[model samples]
Target: MRAPLPLDAVLGLASDLIRAPSQGGIDTPVAVLEVGARALGALGLAPRLLDDENGQPVALMAEIEGGKPGPTWVLNACIDTAPAGDRGAWSLDPFAGVVKDGWLWGRGSADSKIAVASFCHLAAELAKSKDSWHGKLIVLFDADEHTGRFGGIKRFIKERRDIGGVMVGYPENDIVNIGARGFWRAKIEVYGTAQHSGAVSPVPKNATVKLARLIQAIDAVTPPPPPEGAPFPLPPKLTVTGVEGGSGFAMVPNAASLNLDFRLTPAFQAPVAQKLIEGIVAKLDAEIPSERPTKIAALESWGAYKLPADSQLGTALVAGASLAAGRPVPGEVCGPSNIGNYLADLGIPATCGFGVTCKGVHGADERIEIASIPLVWDAYGHALEKLLIG
Candidate 1:
C-alpha cells in the first residue's frame, strides 16, 4: 500500500502547477493536466483526458468507486488562469511559483490552481481510505472556463456520466455560491455623411455624435437591482467598454461604433435586453435623417441562472462547506459563470465558489494566499468526504 500523502505533498503539487504559465489565450495547460493525471493514477484512479475540437487542453475526469453504492459527486476545478499583466507590479516572477512567508505567489496560485491542486490531493487521499461510501466520486478539471466558451466542461458532460451533484472550487473565500448573473455583449453602429470641416453640406451630420447619443440611450436603460424576493442581490447593469469613430482629425467620419457589455440578473431575459438595445438604435435612427441609418449588432449572449436554495446539491454543499470551514456558510450569487449556466441549463444540482483571496486574478502579481492553501485543501477534502463519501 502506498504511504498516505501529506499536506506538504499537496502543496508541492500545487506549487508545480502554479509554476506552469497556463494563462488563457496562451500557454496550454497540458502539462498541468499531465501532472494531475499522474497524481490520480498513483491513487489507483484512472483519469481520462478530454480535449477541445482544436486539441487544446481542456479538462481531466477521474473516477473513484466506493465499496457500496451512493450519490455520485462531481468536484470540478478550472485549470486555466488569466494572463499575468505588467511584470513590474510583482515582487517575484508571476510564473516563478515562489513561496515566501507562508504565501504562494504566482499567476494561477489563487484564482484556480490552488483549488485544482487541493482537490487532487483530497481525491488521492480519499481513494486510499478504508471508509467506504455508497457512491462514486468524480473529479473534473477544465481549461476553457476562463474564456466562457464552454469547451472544456461541455465536452466532459457529453460523456453521459450520471452526475448527482457538482462542487466547483472557484475562489469564493469559503462561501457557498448558489448561482450567478448572466452576460450579453453588443455593438452599436451609427452612420452619417462624411464632409470636409471647411465645407458645410446641406445635410452635415457627425456619426460620432450619433454614436454618442446611442451610447447614452443604452446607458439610460441600466437594469435595477434584484427585487426583495429575488435570489440574487445585484441588478442588471450596462457598460460601454469601447468606442471608435473618425478616421482622421479633419474628417467628419461617416460611421462610428460603440461596444456595450451588459450583466443580466436572473429576472432579465436576453431577448428583452436585445429588444431594448434595438429600441435605442431605432430611436437614434429616427433622430437622424433617412440618409443615415443606425444599427445594433449583438456580439454574444449568455443567460442568467439561479440554482434553487432547496436544491439537493446546494443544501449539501452549504452543509459540507459550513462543516469544513467551521462556520455557517453564507450563500451568495455571483456574476455569470459557464459552470452555473451549464448546471442550471442541464438541471444538474451544482454550486461553485471556493479558493483563496487572489488580489490580481487577471492582472499583474496574480497570487493566492499561501497560508490559505492548506485550509482550502482541508475544507475541500472534508466537504467532499461529507457530501460524496457519505
Candidate 2:
C-alpha cells in the first residue's frame, strides 16, 4: 500500500553504504549499523542495536508488526565485505560507489551494499503500511560474513533463538542458492632449525624447503573425484591459501605456516575430513625427520549441510524470484558459503542469494547491474508477503 520504495533513495543509500567501507573482519561494523539504524528509526521502526557482552554491536535489527500474526521473517544483508585488495586494479575507486552506464561499480556495490540499501527501504515501507500486511519482518544488517569468524550473524543467531524463516541477501544472479559448500579453516606449520641463509644452503634444511615438502605431501593427497555428473560448480577439496614464512634474505626461515582451506561435499563429513587432514600431517612427520616436524591444526571445520526437510519458504522465494526476474528462476544453485551450513546446523530453513547479479565478487573492478537492484528487492518483499499469507 505504501509507495514502492523510491528508486532515487535506493541508489543514494547504496552509494553511501559502499563509501562506508565495513571490510568484514578488518573494519568495525558499528559505523555501518549506526547509519542503517538512523535510517530505520527515521522511518518509524524501532532499530535496536544488539551487541555482545563486551559491548561490540553485532548489528542493528528493526522489527515491524503487521496487521495480523503470521510467520516471522528474517531479512538479512551483510554490512561487511571482503577487503578490497590491490586498489590499483579497479578502474574506479573501489569505494567510490559509482552509479553510471546502468551499473553500480565498487567493492561492495554488487556483493551486497545494494541489498543493504534495498532491504532498508523495504523495512520502512512495510512499517509505514503495517496495516496492509500480516506477520512480522526483521531487517538485519550483519557483520563478518566475508571473514567467517564468530561474526555478527553468528552472534545474532545465538542471541535470537526463536527464529522463523530466513532469507539472505547475497548475490546469485536472481537465482536462489539452495545449498552452500562447507569448508575447513586450517594452518599447516613446518618447523626447522633457523640459521643464516649461507649456512643452510648446503643441506637445504630451512623452513621454506620443509614447507615445499609439506605442500608436496598435501598435493599427493587425492580425494575421490566428484561423482559423475555432479551439479556443483566446483568440487570440494583442499586449497592452499597463504604461505607464512621467510622474513628476509639474510635469515633462514625456521617455521613456515601454510594456511589451507578444505572445501567439503556431501561425500565427506566433518569426522572424515578431520582425519584426512591429520593423516597428511602424520605422513609428512614420519616421512621427513626433524626435531621440529610438520604439524597441521584445524582452526575450524564444518561439514556441508543439505536441507533435510523440503522448505516451503524456499518455494515461496523461488516464486518471488520469478516475479522479480520476469522469468521462472530455479531455487537450486551451488556456491561457496559457510553461513547456510551454520543455519542448517541449527535447524533453520536458510539460504543465500537474493541480490543484484555480480561480477568479480572477490576480484578487481567488482560490479553489478543497476537494474537488478530493484528487481530482487521487489521479489524479496513479495516473497515475504506470500509466506505470511500462507
Candidate 3:
C-alpha cells in the first residue's frame, strides 16, 4: 500500500520533539504540544487544542473522519518528558537532540516522544490513504503524563467515555505490551505528644522515632514472591519515599508522616495490600505503648491490568507489528505504565509497543534507536489498518 513511513522524516520529527524541552512536571509541555499540533496540521488534519476545563491539564486532539461509519479508534501518546536529571552524567547536551551512532539522544527520545512521533507518522500516512479505513482516528497529545498527577488522560476520559478502545504508545522495549503491574500510594501518620527535646530522653515518645520504627517494621515484612512459573512476572515491592513532620527545631514534633510507595503483582490488589499493611501496624502498635498511635491512609491505588487472553487489541498487535525484538513472545512483557494500567482498568483493549526503548529514563543521556523509528511507524500503521479496515 502506501510506502513505508520515511525513516528520515520520522527521525526528523523526533528531533523536533526532543529539541523542545517538555520535561515532565517541570516544563509546561506547551511547546511539545505545539510541535505535535503543527505536525498534524501540516498533514491536512484539523487539530484542536483541548483544555482540561475541570482544571489545569490540557491536551491537543486531532480527528480524521473516515469515509465510512465505524467505531472511533484512539491513538494516545504522552508529550511530557521526565526531567533530565544530573546533566553532567550525560555524554551530550540533554536538550541538544543529538543524532549520533545511529541513535536519537535526548531526554524524551524514548520515554516517549518517539512514540508520539510514531503517531504523527501514522497519521500522515493514513491521511494520504484515507479511503482504506472505515472509522475515525482520534490522535491525543496527552499533556500531563509525568506531572506525577496523570492529569491529561484522567481529565479526557472524564469528559468522554464511549471510546471503542485506545492504542496507547509507551516504551515497552519492542514488544506490544498488553498488561502492567499494580502500584499503590499512601501516607502514614505517626502521632506523639510534642514536648521540648531538652526534656526528652532517647527522644522520648517522639513522632519521628515512631515513624522510623514503623517504617522499619514495614521493611521487615516479606511479601509473598511471584508464583512459581508465573505467566506474568513482577515481584511485589514497598519503599518509603518521603518523611515529613516537626513544627520547629526547638520541639519534638507531634505528628510525623511517611510516604508509602508500593509496586504490586496481581497477587496483591489494593484491599489486600492495605490489609497487609494494617496488620503490620496493628502488630507494631501492640509492641508500643498506647500513648503512641499510627494511622495510614491510601492516597491512590491501581491493580495490575491484563487484557483478555485473546484480546482484540493484543491479537492485532501480535499479528500486525514487526518488531526488532521479534514479535511479543507471550507471557507478560511490560513494566509500570500509566497508559496500560489506566486502560486496563477501563476494560479497554489497549496494547503498548514501540520500536525502541531508551536507556536511563528519568535520568541523564536518554536515547532511542534511530532506525527503529520507521519500523514502529510501520507497525502502528499496520495495527491501525487492521483495526480500521477489517
Candidate 4:
C-alpha cells in the first residue's frame, strides 16, 4: 500500500501560507506565491515564478516529469483569498493560522491555501515514485484569482499548450464538480435633467426613479431554462449588484448607474441575455425619455460548459472520490462560474471542484476541517494514478 500523505508537514506548510497576507485587492499576492515557491523547493522540486509584462509574479509552477510520455495533467489552486471581513467577528486573528479543535482557521484556510500545500506535497510524493505513472504533473499556484483578474492562469495557458486536463483545488467533498455556470456582467448608466430641488419651472427628470424602474424590469426577467437533457439543470439568474446616484439632498442628480450580474446557462447564453437587456433598455428609453440614451457597457463574460458523464477527467475524479469517501460520489455541475469556465472556453477539460470540506468561505471565521485532508489526498492521488498510470 502507498504511504500515507505527510499530514503534519502539509498542515505546517498550510499554516505558513495562511499566515501570509494575500487578500484580493487588499494585500499583495506575490508574497504568498513566494512562500509557495519555497514550500515546493523544500519538496525537492525546482519551482519557478511566472511573471506578467510588468515583471510581477503572477503564478508559481513546478513540474515533475515521468520517464514515459503521455498526457500532461495540471493541479491548480489559487493563493489569493477574499478580503477578511469584520475581523472583530472572528474568535482568533484571521491571519494567525490557528489550529484548534481539529480545524485550521484563517482567511485562506478553506478558500485554497491548504490546497496549495496539499498539491505540493502530493507532487513530491509522486516524484519519488515516478516509475508508477507516465507523462508529467504540473503544480500551479495562481494569484489574482479572487480579484477576478485571473492573470496567473491566463498567463500560464497563453504560454503553454500541452495541458491535457486540469483539476482546480476548490474546497468541497461531497461531489466532484464537472462544470460551472457562466456569467454576463455589465454596467448600465442612466442620464436625466439636473436642476435645483426648489425649481418648479423646469421639471427635472429623476434618474434614480428611472434606475429603479430598470432594476424592477430586470428583476422581473425570467431567463430561459437549461437544455432539454442537461444532466445538471442550472437556471439563469440576474441581480442588480450596485447602484450609485444622487450625492446630496439639495440638487437633483443628473446621472446614475447600476451594475448588472447575470448568470448564464447553455440555453440562456451571453448573446441571448445581452439582446434581451438591450431590448429592455430600448423600450424603457422610448417610454421615458432621458437626456441621453441609457448605455450598457459590457464587462467580462464567460460561456457555460458541462462535461459528459463519461468524460475521462470527470469519471476518474468521481471514482477516486467514491473510493475515498467509502460511498458513491456523484459528478456535479456547480452553480457559480469558476476557473473551469475559463479553461472550457479554450476547449480544455477541467474538474472545477473537489477537495477537503470547509466552512465560512469568503466570510468571517473561515476554517478547514483538519480530518478531511487525508481523504482529499487519497482522492486526488487515486485519480491521478487512474489518469496517468492508464
Candidate 5:
C-alpha cells in the first residue's frame, strides 16, 4: 500500500538516542532529544522542547497539519529511561546503541527510544504525502516519564485541549493495550509502647511485632473478582511493598510503617479498596490494642478505565495491527497502569502498549527486534490512514 518506512534512518536515529544518557530523576540532557528534533527539523517540520514548571525541558513536540481539517492525534513515546542497573551484567555496553543479530541493543531501546525514532520518521512520511490523510499528527516525546511524576505528559494535556486521541508507543507488538488497571497506594503507621528489652513484666508492645501482625492481616485479604463481563479480567491484588521502622535490638521500637499498593479492577474501585483496607486496619486496631491506633494515609489513586468496543481510536488501531499481523490482534487491557490512565482521568481517549517486540525491558541487556520495526510502522501508519482519511 504505502512505501516501506525509513528503516535505516529510524535505526540510525534510535541508535543516537540510545547512546545518549537521558535517565529520569537526573535532568534529561537536551542534547539527547535534539537528535530527534533535528531529524524532524530536516523533514520541514518545526520541533521544539517543552519544559516543566521549573523550566526544565521535559518533552519534545513536532506537528504536521494535513491538507484538510480533521481531529488531531498524538503519537507519543518517552525519551527518558529507567536507571540502567548493574552495568557489569550487560553483555553489550548499555549505551552503545549496538545493532547486531537483527536487534537494536541498549537502555531505552525497547521501553521506548525506538518508537520515538519511528514516529518521527512516520510523521515525515505523512508530511511528504499530505493528501493521503487529514487532521494533525503531533509527535510527542516525553522526557520525564520514568521518574513516575509524568510531568511532561501533564503539561501537554493541560496545554493542548484540542487533542482528540493519543497513541502511546510502549513496546509490545502482539497485543494492543486499549486500557489498563488502576492503582491505589498508601502508607500505614503502627504505634506501640517503646520499652527496654530487659523489662519482662509489662512485656512491651514491640512496633515491629505489631507491624508484622498488620502485614499478616493485609496479606490475608482476597479482593473480589471483576464483574462477569468486565472488559479487563484481571482481579484486584494487594501488595505490601515496603516495611520500615525499628533500630538497634537493645530497645523496643515505638513506631513502624509499611507501604501498601492495590491494583484495582472495575468491580473493586479505589474508594472500595480504601474502605476494605481501612476496615482491616480497624479490625487490627481493636483486636490488638496498642499505645496508638494504626493510621492509613492514601498517597495516590487512579481508577481503572477501558475504551468502548466501538471506540474510533481502538478500532482503527486493532484493525491496523491485525492487518500488519495477517491475523487477529486483540485489543486487550494491560495489567499495569500507564500514561493512558492519566489521560482517562482527563477525559481524553488513549491507546497504549503497541509497538515492536522487546526483550529485557527495564532489565539488563534491553533490546528490540530490528525486523519488527516495519510491522510497528505499518500498523500505526495504517491506523492513521483510517482515522485521518476515512
Candidate 6:
C-alpha cells in the first residue's frame, strides 16, 4: 500500500491544478484530471476520465473499493471556472497559480478546483490507510457546471445507478445547501425588411424598434403562481441578458436578437415555462406583423427544485455541517444552482453546498483564501466520515 499523502503534497496538487487554465469554454479539464489521476494512482486508487460527444473532457471519476457491503457515497466537485475577465484588475496573472498572503490566486482556486483537490486528497489518504469503511467512495470532478447544463452529473447518472448519496463541494462556507432556484434560457429574434433611407416613407419599419417593444412586453409578463406545496419563500423571476441588432450604421438593421434568462422557483416546470414563453412570443408576433416578420427562438430550458428541510439527507447534512463548523449552521436557499435540479430529477437523496467562503466566484480577482482551503478539507472529511463511515 502507498503512504498517505501529507498536507504539503495535497496543497501542492491543488496549486498545480489552479495553475492549469481550465476556464469554462477554453478549459482543459483533462489536464487537471491528469494531475488528479497521478495523485490517486500514487495512493493506490483508480481514476477514470470521461468525455462528452465533442471529446471535450467533462469529468473524472475516482474510486476506492471496500470489502464490506454499504451504500456508495459520491464526492463531487466541478473542475471548470468562468473565464477570467480583464487581467489588469488582478494582482497576479489569473492563471499564474501564485500563493501569497496565505491565499492561492487563480481562476479555479476557489470556484471549484480546491474542492476537487481536497476530495482527491481525502480519497488518497483513505486508500493508503485502508480505512475500515463499509461503503464505496466515488469522487466526481465535472466540467460544464458553470454553464448550467448539469452536463457531467447528468452523464454519470445515466451510466450508473448505485449512487446512494452525493456531496457537492460548492462554496457554501460549510453550510449544507438543500435547495436551489431553477432556471431556463431562451433567445428571441426579429426580422425586418431593409429599405433605402431615400425610399418613399409610407410606413417605415425598423426591426430594432420592434424588437425593443417585444422585449418590453415580454418583461411585462406576470410570473406564474407558486407551486401549491412549495417550501421555498420566493417565486420564479426573469431577466433579459443580451440583445443584438443593427447591421450597419447608415441603414436600419433588418434583424435583431435577444436572450432571455429566467430563474424560477421550484413550483414551475421547464415545459410549462417553455409553453408560456412560446405564447408570449406568439403574442408579440401577432402584435408586430411581418411587414417584416419577427421570430421567437427558445434556446434552452432547465427545471428547478427545492429539497425539504426536514428530509433525511437535508437534516443529516445540516447536522454534519454544524458539527464540522463547531457551531450551529443556519440553512437557507437564496441562490440559483443546479444541485437541486440534479437531486430532484435523478431521485437522488443528496446534500450540497460544502466549500470555502469565496467572493467574486464568477467575477474578477477570483480567489480562494489559502487559510480556508484546509478548513474546507477538514470539514468535508468530517462530514463524509459522519455520513458514510460512522
Model 3 residue 102 CA deviation in Å = 1.6
Q: Model 6 shows how many backbone clashes?
A: 1
Clashing pairs in 3: 24-81
The alpha-carbon deviation from the true structure for residue 347 of candidate 4, after best TM-score superposition, in angstroms, is: 0.6
Q: Give Cα distance to truth, residue 112, candidate 6, Å.
A: 0.3
lDDT of 1 at 190: 84
Model 3, residue 98: distance off in Å is 1.4
Candidate 5 residues 1-390, lDDT tens each? 467887888999999999888888765658778887888898788998888888988889998888888889999999989988899999899999999899999999998999999998888886777766678889999988999888889888778978889999999877999999899999999998887888777777888898999999999988888778767788999999999998887778999999999998777889999999899989888988886899999998888888999899999999999998898999999888989988988888999879999899999999999989989999999998888888
How accurate locally is residue 233 in candidate 1, as Cα lDDT from 0 to 100? 83
TM-score of each: 0.88, 0.91, 0.91, 0.97, 0.95, 0.88
Model 2 per-residue lDDT tens digits across residues 1-390? 436658888888888888888887788887777777777777677888878667888777887778887667888888778899999888899888898688888888876778888888887876666665667788887766777664677778876767776888888564687677778778888887777777735655677887898888777777777677765544677778898898978787888899988788777666677788787777777776677767768787655755433677788888888887889988764647656777877777776776787788878988888776777878887787687654
Candidate number with the higher TM-score (2 or 3): 3
Which of the numbered candidates is closest to the native, going by highest TM-score?
A: 4
Per-residue error for 145 in candidate 4, Å, reads 0.5
**How many clashing residue pairs are found in candidate 4?**
0
All models, RMSD in angstroms: 3.0, 2.5, 2.4, 1.3, 1.8, 3.2
Segments in model 5 whose C-alpha atoms lie over 4 Å from true places: 196-203
Positional deviation of 206 in candidate 1, in angstroms? 3.4
Q: What digit string (tens of lDDT, one per residue) describes model 4 on residues 47-135?
A: 99988879888889998888788888999999999999899999899999999999999999988999999999998887887776678
Which model is ahead, 1 or 3, in terms of lDDT?
A: 3
What is the Å distance of residue 378 in model 2 from its true position?
2.4
lDDT of each: 0.75, 0.77, 0.76, 0.90, 0.89, 0.73
Put down candidate 3 lDDT per residue, 169-266, tens digits, no spaces. Answer: 77644456777777888998888777887874676567777778898988887878878888667677888899898976789887889998887777
**Which of 4 and 6 is ahead in lDDT?**
4
Structural RMSD, model 6: 3.2
Off by over 4 Å in 2: 1-5, 128-134, 200-204, 228-234
Give me the runs in candidate 3 sitting further than 4 Å from their true place: 54-57, 172-174, 200-203, 229-231, 246-250, 290-292, 322-333
What's the count of clashing pairs in each model shown? 7, 0, 1, 0, 0, 1
